[model samples]
Target: MNESKFFWQACRLLWMSGILLVLISWGSDVPVSTAVSNISYATTITVDSSRDVSTSLSERCDTHTPCTLRRAIVQARLLAPAARPVLIQFDIPTSDVGYDASQELWELEVKSTTDPAVFRTVEGGQVTIDGTTQPHGRVDGPKIILVGPATGNKNGLIIGVNASGSHDNNIVRGLGFQNFKDHLTINSSHNTIEDNWFGLTSEGQQPYLRNDNPQDGSGSAGVVLISGAEQNLVQQNTFLAFDGVAIALRGNDNTVRHNQIGTNALGLLTLKQTSPSLLCTPEDWLGGGGISADGTGHLIEENIIAGLRQQIFAISTQPDAIWVQSTCTSCTIQNNQVGVDAEGHEVGVCGRGFYLTNTKQVQVIDNVLAETYHSALFLNGALYDANTLRGNIIRKSTPWLIPDDSPKGDDAILRFTGLPDPLEFFNPAKITHIEGTTVSGTAGDGSPCPNCVIELFLDDNDNINEALESVAVVTAKADGTWSATLPTPLADGFGLRTSSTTAQFNTIANISAGTTVGLSELYMPGYVGYLPLITR
Candidate 1:
């Protein structure tokens, strides 16, 4: 009996051991699936100075090592390549903690050596980098996104994404890039920058970099540098107090529309390079203007540019504004309004309505210039043939002198050759006379004279001869007065000749040198017929 009981106990122990081994195997396999699932996964990276870095908020935070935000970004880029839509949230104190106006939070260097196909999505972070990071170098990249905080103190987030032949197909949305030094240079193709607040202060330095040195003066510009980028879209941005241009574009086949660019030294400036020698100068640079396109086959339309000291200066600023040097061809500046001030004086100095220089095959149409200090359209240098200026409303105002030249008011329409006066042929005061005249005869008394015969003659060949066929008849009234309403003839030549007579007069009196007698009816004798004159 004892041996049988012992056998039962041994069997029970073996079963229990088998169950424990099964649990151990299951635990070992579960970890492998968990590690594999994390590959190419979407993750959130949050940066806060107060939180302990070692805390395992997620699987990403494994250690407590102190790392810079810029380093964290580099790691994220290396770790995740296929996983899309990664968000980086920045929780920095506005007034006290990590908010250092003197120092930069992040600086991204884009150069030609960088890969153009790597796509990165960056959001909700601040970056500060000066020219010293890599002085005199260009930053290039493709597809970088920058996002800002939703609700916090208005500390003015600053970020610089300067690229040269790099940033193609990238998007920058929802941030206040204030006091950014140097130009937010972009020389890439197919990039979009929209929905950001940009503030400017001076004419030569960026606003964000201006705080670095009190003496190293640079202009505050919203978006200054652009060259050789194609099909870029810059829309829905606010540029305030910028000394340089709000948006300076120098690429082909780009669209800049629907942006509120104001309160700058100069609004928008565009450039194109013929030989690449006639680009903008250091002194000619102003802080205001909105969206100037200086490359061939580009479009600048439907943008609100106001309160600028200088509105739109499209001169040969180094690279040029449309066509480089003298080869700007096939560009269009249409449907834009300038010179409407939101505040300040009714008239502002250092302002230009729209300046065009050395361009061809361009069209400027459907623009309204109201209360400006200079001419609505200033065409300088050599404007080529086949260019058009139509449907523009220029409001009338007193002349304001810009340096040596006095620009006509908003309503002034000017077309000049060389340095001659533009108003010689386009005189606004000249009255245009219509087609025929009226004649009345008086009776021996001072009463009305009816039944008067009147002769009509063509003044010049410039008049519409075809129009005379429909309404070219006149009859004397009861008071010896007659009136005629001339009709224009149609191209088909099927219309009536006159009301009074079917006979057409081929020749009439020559009134230029007064009246002369003994003149034959100037006609091709047998070609057409006319009524013989019956003298009263």
Candidate 2:
């Protein structure tokens, strides 16, 4: 082809590709111009405390006029995607409702009228409800929102208004959430819940969840994250009496960092027994521990846990400060302080600092845990490479502390049994289903690796590394399986299908070229953690 002709052809190809990208973008609910328009007006709406108020439609909310917090949220939603973000700011040191702000401390309440009684709901992207407006707050000053030695509201702040902000930025910061059944329940991704207080009234009173089951200490859904919520920042928050499972996560890659969690209850929780994939309600969240987490690739770090158990004001079982399950793959719980000085200050009411189980490549490192009823760290049945458990400090509480020290068999730092070796290969499963020219699978142990990748290579030279002749790449389902069709369909053998995300014993399939694979011939790579053992 002539130079001029070739240049035009290349330009046409580029133009067509750009048009295709635009079409794909247009397929979504948001348009580029719409998002740009939203970038303009940073609408700051204010609320005057109106108790039990709600918004239906055509209700107006803005700084010029006064509206309830709920009504402001409704108005914000209406103005979003055009404004891109709508900030909800609390009025000065007081509200229209009788929230006596006599001492520079402002307060309000969101009582539950709904069946499960949620205080308020937040959704959408790029929305911020900042309570720190200099006078009301400071970067390094006293917290202004107070509960005045009285009680707080009844429910919690639900953060998934029908799955809004599932992929955008939504932030709630610097507010004191007190006496709610649970503090914050987040079911969206990339949201930030930080620099806030939970479980304490304005006057720094411990807010107790109406614990229905005191005997077992099971009640209240602390902070919850579910519905595939990923990469959220829950940081620098404080919790008072409403601990035992202060935060519950049922999602992937959500970060719980730099928060002051735990007062009289376990700090954080993540369970799969009742909660499952792509589903889990805040109501389904279980209580227990400062960090009771069960998921893949979560980073829990630098949080202070003072008392990882709910005293219940009665006889009850205490939980760990940090709890991890085996299903948690490559999760790191690190660099956290879990106790205080012996002057009636410390974490764990006879509870462990770390209780880990069924975890994969989990690291429990560099935590100072004291004043516990049991071992500081307890490990049971999980996959651990050199990456797990190092540089930790465990010591007994001083004399005259509550919960008489059981120094006999449980007051140690590290305890483990029946744990899986890092390189151990066990019951791993993968399933494949054909969808048009694409193939997908759910890949992992019994649990799921939600956003796992699968790669197919045409080179079946039996060299796992060298077979880089690219074919196709596919992602697994929420269940951790994967499938990908070859560049060309073969009957079966001589191709390779591998879980691109692998451990020491990564699962890779050696397809019989010219032969079609159905479910799979579960791979047994030489080395799973990184490179194949053979190559090494």
Candidate 3:
């Protein structure tokens, strides 16, 4: 063929590929320019009153008139199909309607269960409800609060109207949610919940004092992503002192990062109770922990979870800091500070750091856990296989087997079931010598690991891998011996550790005991205290 004819054919193929990509984006409900129109005018709505009144169909949102939050939501939902990506901002003054003078706060109570305080995105439309525009808000937190009803299981803000709707690409930010069964529930995908405070006052210094007279016994949750909700981001929020889990994540492919669970806003203090009368009853079923996750491809990272336990409740069992259910797979938990405060102080949790059962291909890496009353890592039985635990630091974890085990703190860090030879399955990399960046190690003990991958790290004196710098990676010989030369000379006064990954199942093991450069060493166990990696 001629050169001009060939170039014309190539251009045709490129145009066809672009059409196919647009179709795929629409099938996944992605907001491309073709799928969703950018309505610049008449897309911004403002709420000047804190009243919880419904709006009529004829009276849509007008920027000049006074509107309530519920009215703003109704107006946004009633927009034409062409108008989308609406922004609902607040401009309520101190003397606005529904503002309490004695309490000095603006509270929007849910008026009805049928039309609750919710943000339901229309199909192919997106919405953002921002409370940062409130005049009385603090510099760091929100000033407007959403309160639930007195006697029912009401949610503060729901992303989808129902399970049947594909309400996607909505955002709720810079708000305070309290006194609801669930502060927020997302039944849609591609939503973002950031910079919000759950179970706390707008100032983020105290819990919201509820006015429930009889004290509704329904448990509370910070944020809940229901099943089939995928690709959502829950970040930079404070979840404190709820009766149930801080984040009940039942979605797939979601990312929950940089949120404070079971702690104060700054993570410098432990969480306090939301109300003195709100207690967990014997029949409550959802009080799991900081994060109760049950789906695949989830990432829970960089959160501080501590002080989550009920002191006066009929069900006295405390919750795990992070619980991955049996059905989950390919989830990653990394860079989280569990069972401790942000300052590395021992603000202990009543349960284990991680409670994993029958999970497959889960990675728990580079987490620092301290002062857990139960074992730091708990695998229920032999059915839990093909999971990886690499570069974790645990201190002051106790053995908790039964209901009343008499609380021996910091005694054990691991509890795995039915491992006859624990070392064969859980062998840490052993560094025998390190001379001028060439580090040598025994990567295996027996048949559990062969031709393993040894990963070396340079942590700054602390045992934990804080900077996530992997200095070197080398493969072990079939005989279980390995050696790797780094790119640069090993620095003085810096600590080093190695983590081993087995060749057969690709399972990553815990990091070896740290070794200081140029220092002679006795044999150091992988775990610092009483227990080994697993117990029979």
Which regions of candidate 3 are displaced past 4 Å?
1-42, 53-66, 100-105, 112-124, 162-165, 209-219, 270-288, 311-316, 397-415, 418-448, 454-475, 483-500, 506-536
Candidate 1 is scored at a TM of 0.47
Give TM-scores for every candidate, taking all chains together and pairing residue i with residue i: 0.47, 0.58, 0.71
> Model 3 over residues 177-284: C-alpha lDDT tens digits?
867777788888878787678877555554453453122222368888888888788876778766668899987988886677766555555333323233233222
Model 1 score (lDDT): 0.36
Model 3's TM-score against the true structure: 0.71
State residue 291's C-alpha deviation in candidate 1, in Å: 4.3
**What is the lDDT of every predicted structure here?**
0.36, 0.49, 0.60
What lDDT is reached at residue 149 by model 1?
Answer: 22
What's each prediction's clash count?
61, 59, 0
Backbone clashes (count) for model 3: 0
Across residues 368-462, which tens digit of lDDT does each residue of candidate 2 receive?
66555555665555334333444454445332222344322442323243544322332223434443345444554443344444544332333
- Residues 14-111, candidate 1: write the lDDT tens digits: 32232111111211121111111222326444533322233122223223344333433443443433443343444434342333233323222221
Top of the candidates by TM-score: 3
Weakest lDDT window of 10 consecutive positions for candidate 1: 510-519
Leading candidate by lDDT: 3
